[model samples]
Target: MREIVDFDNLKMYINGEWVTAQSEKTYSVINPSTGKVVANVPNGGRNETKQAIDAADQAFKSWSKLTAVERAKYLMRLYALMHQYKDQLAEIMSLEMGKPFTEAKGEVDFAASYFEWFAEEGRRIYGETIPSNSPNKRLMVIRQPVGVVAAITPWNFPLAMMTRKVGAALAAGCTAIVKPASQSPISAIAFGRLVELAGIPNGVISVITGSSGPISDEIFENPIVKKVTFTGSTEVGKLLVTKSAHQLKKLSLELGGHAPFIVFEDADLEAAATGAIASKYRNTGQTCVCANRIYVHQSVIEEFSEILVKKVKELKVGNSIDPTVQVGPLVNREGLLKVEEQVKDALDKGARILCGGKRVGGELTEGLFYEPTVLGDVTPTMLITYQETFGPVAPIIPFESEEEVIQQANGTEYGLASYFYTQNISRAVRVAEALEFGIMGINDSIPTVAQAPFGGIKESGQGREGGHQGLDDYLEYKFISLGI
Candidate 1:
């Protein structure tokens, strides 16, 4: 692939300008597929983070005053630019994040859809006239931007996660300072270049690359930052909540998920197996909502396992740059270790390895790669039962009844997403309602879209990310009362 943007020359974006960290410190961005350094990014600290915040605070005074329609135009431009540079962005993400090129291209489209969706949604931020107790008195409610926003995005789905949060915030008329994960800051910098080309005003959007602790500390302590949006582990989400507590900053967290994929006996076995593979192994199972535990009906466990293992064995695992590869390397050694540990734990506890259960050697690439794993006879006593195994491993447990499956599925503290395959309409409705998750897919594996509300309940974290509800967390409501 030819290089469009100069990744080696990238810099942090602040106040609508390309700049480097004041500390002059830098860190290398490693390509997970080859374990090679792609580029060096500025390792910003508190000073750089504070400067970005100040810039955003200054810009908010004017940015928040623009009409929703006017603001939508900028997002429209961004949406267009994202499409114009779609291939390049995907290439950047694939090279830096180690997802297959095909999957990365799909993610580029998914990320652009957010901007397109919000461009129209911004114009619909309507206020309401309320009924008054007295004829002479008028009551009204209006929503406005929630000032400066701090978005802390994750490494997985780097572009999509940034657009999901920043698109809504900017559409709602808020200036933003983004702190992208250090592992994948190049993608954010590339987006920043687009933001500049899109003619978004200086200070309206800033991308700061740095250590998480210093950036987070500055964000929490800075009073100018009115709201904080984050997507990461549940442990980090809790820490952010605690940090922002004293400041009373508005928070929208999309945290860790231990999603359950259930297969009913009456469902189509082939379709169920296909859906399970799609949901469990996408992006090498690095996604937060990837199905961690699978529950299959006792009657169909044997048949389902056969189909699932066959499909999994056929998955192509190699470097992400290959167009035909489906399963790519883990982002780092840490992730690979986690996957190995989980698989070992399940095997030690009597779970049978249905298909694969080992690390891949460097015949493909000398990077962190683990085989797409499937474990049968998984019980609750295994570590994979409760922990968020963020890897390419599927642990299948047999369930005798619908009630038994639901109980076991909802047993986890994390409830971001859940899926089930059922042809019976009544059973579908009953189970969908009973599942303790913010997002559910009935006979569908991938349910996330730009037009629908995406969030979680229980320990998965709070607030919504997409749809009309996405703009809510970035806005503040004010009620007006007038008497003649």
Candidate 2:
């Protein structure tokens, strides 16, 4: 059965009202599964973005003044709504982003976890009382909301990325303007409805979809937008850093990652191979923390490559809406082209393709579907090794020693996430620290959780998301003293 999404009557939410876009333009969202246009998302420009920010700014004065318990109630309500609509949101994500339905559901569920986590954090937001050295004097520190926030998210994991930012901001009592990726705006718009159903105040949360460049610039220029939170490529993240710096606006970014999965000798080979299948193939390898480069010790390279090749070959590449499919198409034509170019470059640079490396014949030729590819004999100098692939391609390279592999993994300009497979506890600890990344996995690929802080290091971008600390990004501290 083909799924249909209605976007014709879509409108931007400003001050709790769904209003028509100032610009009479729309973009067609194509289903990568069948190469069919599923929805017509409104192409909002700078004007709509401004309206959202202004509304949020006006709402923040009252919102930030509310008691933490009151704010927590709203988040709790939102969380309940998300749970009620998880299936629909997951289906929408699969249709829009080309992720396997099961994985999409997982992301939707994870997204809901944010609301729950931050909602609890709301009641627990604490201020410190510092003891003074002088007699008859008291000192204390307090934390307060940073005011209106501009949250820009990517298309890969629409729901999770949006909630990761907005959930914390709302829990901290900040109003927000969400500018979701233009490519996949359906789920985000659906999220807007959930906010309303949850009894959130007008302008406390607004959704703006379309061209983000001009809108982003406007929001950055607006003095009322006290913070900017984004999740995307490092190149764009750098620009936001500079723009935020101009006004010294508070910023949190979860940018690009080329996570390396290292397999050392004396490790559980079977477990490592299975882990790779899950980590590298999730969301068709579109995740920021997906394992792109596999660094195998020379002694185990041949065995690991053989097992990995067999697994890659077994991946069912087809429509994301199909429950049985394991891998889906890329997000769009541009992504397909980028992956094609990277694969071709690797082959040209003496790398060998072991399994699937080309597009498959399906109902959608124009749709972006790249085959799950496995490349061997990749050199450290190739772009695939140092740069993020961000597709359904996994390249494996051989390393002789732990020291050499660690150096190779850390060579990239990006240091978002890295993984290792070894039974030696001491070596795991040693290699974990040696690898200069924000997140690491020992015999695992999934490093993020609602209880643990997630972010990157170096050029992978700045700040953290998820966990109890996620709300800290939205708060500023003040110290006060009293003396007789």
Candidate 3:
């Protein structure tokens, strides 16, 4: 990838001011692919977070008073600025998080798309008048901003997740404070430049980095914050859900995912193979919605496995900067170890590894790069069959019948995304309906987009993230009755 942006010491953006932590301490952020220090991000504490929350709280009064159209105009400008700096944003994301250059650029587009989409959606935030039983009475419902919002984003898709939450919140006329994951904070910090260039008020959008735990505690306890939006693990989400109950603050949690990908006997062999590969290997399978459990009809398991292994072998595993690299390193050491554990546990339990099951370390460099692995004879008993192994490992589980496959697929705590390949129209519709997941892809590998509502159910997570309902989490309804 061609380099374009300068990586600088990004301090915390709080209360319309660029400031460091009260203690003047910082933490080192590492590039996963190169194993090099990227920058020293501010180690913000309660003091810094208090400043951000206070700014957002104060700004909300004027910011929410603006017409949706006015707020949307600011978002439109933001969208344009995001495009203007797309190359730089992509480079920063790739350097910070190790996504392939091409993929990072695509992520830039996906993130910017939310601003453009929510800009239009903001203008259409409509009010409705209900028919009154009495002639002198008038009843109506109006939508309003949910007040100050705190968006906690994950490291997997730093820029996109930040925009997904912050864009919608801003469009809903809510001021926001974004806390990016410690693993990758540069993308979130650099995004402040675009918001500033767009002329959005400083407190209307703030990006804070540092000790997220203390920052979150202050936000949760403060009465100024009205909503908490998070995209991370279910464990942490449950903790937030429990703590947010103190003030009963609204919450939007897009948590963990253990998605299932199914391939029936009637599926196009080539399509099924490539679709599974696309869903499983993207971001080296670090995505929450990526296919973790794959089910293949017993009749076609051999051919499906054969074609999948062939394609998995063809993927070029290298640094994210390499344009030709299809698979990149894991985000950190924990991710690398998690993948290693899943593969080891599966192999120990009698699962067969067809290709690429070990870590790859080049002599010239040391990084967290694991081979794109494929496992066969995966049983429901194996840990890899149900665990959310967020790695580029495709474990094909054979099923005897449709009923059995659906039973196996839905037999998990997560219900984020599910996929199945079938030429049978009726069967496709039937299985799609039966699968217990928020997003379903029939004959499709990837189904998420800016225009759709993306989220999960059960233990996967709660609430929606995109499309018309994406703004729903940021707005509240008020009913009015007038007597004349």
The window of 10 residues in a row where model 1 has the poorest summed lDDT is 1-10
Per-residue C-alpha lDDT of model 3 across residues 229-301, encoded as one tens digit per residue? 9999989999999999999999999988888899989999899899999899999999999999889988889
TM-score of each: 0.98, 0.97, 0.98
In candidate 3, which residue pairs get closer than 3 Å at backbone N, Cα or C atoms, i.e. clash?
none
The per-candidate count of clashes, in order, stands at 0, 0, 0
Q: Estimate, for each residue in 1-484, the C-alpha lDDT of model 1 and write its tens digit.
A: 3344586677899998888888788999898888899899998989988899999999999999998888889998988888888888887888888988999989989999999999889999999999999999999999999999999999999999999999999999999999999888988999998899889999999999989988999999999999999999999999989999998999999999999999999999999999999999999999989899899999999999999999999999998889999999899889889889988888898999988899888575488888999999999999998999878999999999999999999998998999999899999999999999999999999999999999999999999999999999999999999998
Ranking of candidates on TM-score, top first: 1, 3, 2
RMSD of 3: 1.6
- Backbone clashes in model 1: 0
lDDT of each: 0.92, 0.87, 0.88
- For candidate 2, the per-residue lDDT at 425 reads 94
Query: Which predicted model would earn the best TM-score?
Result: 1
lDDT of 2 by residue, 1-484 (tens): 1222345676666779776677778787788877788788778878888889889988999999999888888888888877777778888888888988888888888998888888888877899999899989999999999999999999998999999899999989999999899878888888888888888999999998788878898888888899999999999999888898889999988999999999999889888888898899899988899998998999988998898888889888888988888999898888888888888899999999998788876565666788899999999777788768878899999989988988888888888998999999999989988999999989987878877888999988888898888988899999999887
Runs off by more than 4 Å, candidate 1: 1-4
Tell how far residue 26 is off in model 1, in angstroms: 0.5
